[model samples]
Target: MASALPNSLFQQYFNNNDYADIIVELKHPVQDTNCPKSTEYFPMHQIIACSTSTYFKEACFNAETNPIGTKLLFFDISLEAFTIIAAWVYGFRGSSFERLFTEKSIRGVMDFFIDHDLETDIYPEMQELRTLLLKNLFKITTEAEVASATGSPRMDLRSLEDICEYCLPGDRNTIRRLVKQQIPQIKCSAGWLEALAGKSAAGFLASILLEIYQEAQIQ
Candidate 1:
């Protein structure tokens, strides 16, 4: 087997724009006249892109079909989302890159995956995360319905946008009926944002979601 190239080499290739063979552009999902997504452009090597991505491989190498010298591909995703993926492919890894995936940004990334119907293509680990984000959406929606009827504050919300981007709407009436009284109270907590971003707080979040899903499972 041939030897793998060092990440440093790819890093150099990524940074030196004059040597770039392809340009990947991020397209805004929304078309508001006032504001839009970052719609950023990233120029890189065809070899790096083709080696790592099947989509780019098919596009770049299909010379007969793909027009020669036309290298711009529109990626309808958030800048923050594309940055994380692009950085990883170009040898920019670690926590700093991960920080780019804020709660809102990850939701936007997942929206791109969901829009392309690429949920089936995600890794098993990512599938779990997708499931969790969807479940959190469900948990909150159900609680909201219950609260509307019983007059209580919505509880244990992970993020509706985070979930809607991945999962379909569930039966609003069904989960509402399951819990007549909202046993889960809305209590302010510190570090909730940090907790939601990592797996460290997953158990706690899962427990809350479970309680809500299990009809508050309370006496």
Candidate 2:
């Protein structure tokens, strides 16, 4: 048995020109003029990038069409989502992934990976982003909680209940706790019923039901 090497060893090679044999450039449709320099370029290992993503596999290994030294530019992907992806490929499980996977970037990450050929359906690791998105959705740190009680919902929370089927031990409990914090607000929302009505929202609905059942039993 061997103790695993620290993530720093691999992360040192992240975006490092010294070790990088490949480059990645991600482009979103719109970027803030205020923060232009942050999302410029990414230096990556050819083998690591190609192994993790099929898109990179084609770009790096398809010498006939794309070649080895070609710029790997991805369109319609935000820097936040790209950071999550890049961090994952670099074997980063610390602050980088946690800090970037927020409410703002959750939608962008989910939509882009789901649409693009991330092959999340085939690989369980890629689905962590989906789980992060689900967990963030339950983090209702908005005025909606109080507003909904008074009939003026500030949050337009819709289509957020499609929970992913994958779990990593305490993932469900974490999501359950967050949802419990916002359950009052969610119940007040007019669209919660509509959103949770379909088969896709079964897991989300179950979480809510369990919460209610527990509260009732306690009372």
Candidate 3:
């Protein structure tokens, strides 16, 4: 890495900073009849990297020098309001297939949604996020690939029952430990379930199962 490289190297490289340069608003006059403010303002740059690094892959290291998959993110920082706004006019406007899978943008979007201010205008923000997820979903392998990984073909009810049996009562503690250990190993999300069913059944089952899991922990 070059010493003179921008301090936002990680963000720049991973987020395609070369193409998505932050638009900095320099000192400019505000048109206010009551009180016109003319203050010397410099573009303050802020780089926020994710606190968790588990999801990011090793190939991300080559992003700076290679043409690997990376999302182009550009935003404006306002010190006065202590707020950051997406400067969509300055960079790639929407999420594309090239951006999501290679990078951990999906997880980033999930983390962002966790604390997102929904009261504010969320339609545009969510649309962009949805675009990213859909594009990535298209690149995912077939359901058979998942079955191959789990050594079970298309998770049937028997498999679900077997897993559930181990997660009950005395077996529950052991199952919890196993779940923690295998959280990364087993892909059991709405997305995973959908892959198994090839339809909308996953959402219905996920809601029911999540409730079951919650109730089971109550006693």
Candidate 4:
């Protein structure tokens, strides 16, 4: 016998701006030329943000401690990125993905996910978003002119270590291409290499080293 699917009560309220209980204020920093330093407001359901994000969950539920009180302020994240994140929290996956899925926007979203502890084991949506972001990042990394023209931020050693951890055993091509592109700059910094050696998994570390060695040999 075929079983009926359970009703999603929240889906009814999804995208209903009138029912929003929280207001998220996003701001861009003055130093970020890609976006204007301005504030933007996004109406969101407290329950949806709290349920999906640990940081929000703590802030919204533990009002006595956090004292968010219907309004939350976020600094240095672009309005476009926050809009996409807020919409995703409310299950609004639409054409917005095309507009919002840029290198800078993905980085902002990933920062939010990391701060909120949205790991794959705990929040499947976060994992899905991570994969999507990785694809966008890969595309940017592959196009040298585009990357340079956009002034893509260089990934730090810690960020590289995190990427290795996230990407290893799956997206080897992306990692290889990234390593090839960044090896010259990274090789100059012995401190970065040492940091990567200390943090990365043995197998992943070897793969990166192999890529660097191959690039050097080719040169």
Q: Which candidate wins on TM-score?
A: 2
lDDT for each of the candidates?
0.53, 0.56, 0.33, 0.58
Which pairs, if any, clash in model 4? none
RMSD of each: 11.0, 6.5, 18.4, 7.7
Count steric clashes of candidate 1. 0
Per-residue lDDT of model 2, residues 1-219, tens digit only: 111555567678776777576666666654566654444576777666666555556656643324655445544677776777777766777666577666567666766765765534554456654565566645533443445556633233333343333223346566556555555444433244444545452545555545655565577
Model 3 alpha-carbon drift over 4 Å, by segment: 1-97, 118-121, 134-219
RMSD of 4: 7.7
User: What TM-score do all the candidates reach, one by one?
Assistant: 0.52, 0.61, 0.26, 0.54
Error of model 2, residue 74, in angstroms:
2.8
- What's the lDDT of the predicted structure labeled candidate 2? 0.56
- lDDT by residue for model 4 (1-219), tens: 111322145445654567677766667676668876787776667666666655456556654322545645444577767766665555555465456676677777777666656644555556666666776665554454345544543444454555455453555665766566544444424445555566545356555655676566688
In candidate 4, residue 6 scores what lDDT?
Answer: 22
What is the clash tally of candidate 3?
Answer: 0
Point out where model 1 deviates above 4 Å: 1-3, 29-39, 61-70, 122-155, 158-219
For model 3 the local lDDT of residue 121 reads 30
Q: What are the clashing pairs of model 1?
A: none
Candidate 3, residues 1-219: lDDT per residue as tens digits?
A: 112334334333332334432223322235585675444232212232211121111212322332543322322222221111222111223343233243233333433433333212334444443444433322232242454666532333334433332121323343334333333233354445444444342333333444444544574
lDDT of 1 by residue, 74-102 (tens): 77886676665566566555554455545
